[model samples]
Target: MVMETIEKVIVNLGASDIDSRLEELLIDGILYAFQEQIMNDDANVMLNEFGIVVNALGQRVKPYLPHICGTIK
Candidate 1:
């Protein structure tokens, strides 16, 4: 529920409008949630929301690629 709301907000705001520090914090929180929920069957919705947030960030996501890829792997 919260993740969905966050995804919507990010999509509406767009990447450029997000402050770097806040973006970093958001990414960190999403990544943490993903890692924690990876093994949970009910995590699909949250995972989807995380993906949308990542996609919405666009190029701003570059710096976190290694961490993101590592998490996905």
Candidate 2:
């Protein structure tokens, strides 16, 4: 699902536009992945690391993300 969505976006926007859209798409993908993971009992422990990484990456991407995207989720 993530790959297909990204492919569609790239097809529409072109590779050159990746610098702007990459973070947006990546965050969207991560959120979906997290949602799936949370549905499993074993995923709770693993998601700790995942959450940390997402938080750090989100801070770095804050500058380029859309104004609303920068808001706390």
Candidate 3:
């Protein structure tokens, strides 16, 4: 529920409007969630949300690509 809400918020805010610091924090939190909850069913939902957030982030996601891809792997 929370991740869905966050995804919506990020999507509504769009990429340029999001602050870099907040982007870092969101990426960190999502990565941490991926690391800690990969075995759970909720992880699937989180992964979906993560993709939406990544798209919402646009070019801002570049720096975190490797980390995100590694976490997904």
Candidate 4:
């Protein structure tokens, strides 16, 4: 499901002329991967590391994600 969303977002970004959309999809992919890793017991260590990285990266990407995702519209 997450991959699908990423693929769709990437496709949309490629088809559209929007830099924000590209940024949004890139962020979403990072978030989705983090979520998936955190949900698995075997990935607990990775999850912790990713949490810090995502938090730092997310701050930079959060602003444009909603517009590209269309979740608010």
- Assess candidate 2 and give its TM-score to the true structure: 0.37
lDDT of 4 by residue, 1-73 (tens): 4444544554454423435665566556555565455355535554444344334444555564564345312
**TM-score-best of 2 and 4:** 2
Deviation from native of the Cα of residue 54 in model 4, angstroms:
7.7
Where is the poorest 10-residue window by lDDT in model 2?
Answer: 64-73
Ranking by lDDT: 3, 1, 2, 4
In order, what is each prediction's RMSD in angstroms? 2.0, 8.2, 1.7, 9.5
Q: Write the per-residue lDDT of candidate 3 for residues 1-73, one digit (tens) a residue.
A: 6688888787776667768898899899888877877457888898899999988887889999998998888
Quantify all predictions' global Cα lDDT against the true fold. 0.81, 0.50, 0.83, 0.48
Q: Residue 58 of candidate 2: its Cα lDDT?
A: 47
Clashes of 4: 0
- Find the candidate with the highest lDDT and give its number: 3
- Error in Å for residue 13 of model 1: 3.5
**What tens-digit string does per-residue lDDT give for candidate 2 at 1-73?**
4444554554565444344466677666655565555346635543454444444454555653563343323
Clash pairs, candidate 1, are none
In model 4, state the lDDT of residue 5. 51
Q: Pick the candidate with the highest TM-score.
A: 3
Worst ten-residue run, lDDT, model 3?
Answer: 9-18
From the highest TM-score down, the ranking of the candidates is: 3, 1, 2, 4
lDDT of 3: 0.83
C-alpha lDDT (0 to 100) for residue 62 of candidate 4: 57
lDDT of 1 by residue, 12-51 (tens): 8766778899999998988787777645764788778878
Q: Hey, what RMSD does candidate 1 come out at?
A: 2.0
lDDT of 1 at 9: 83
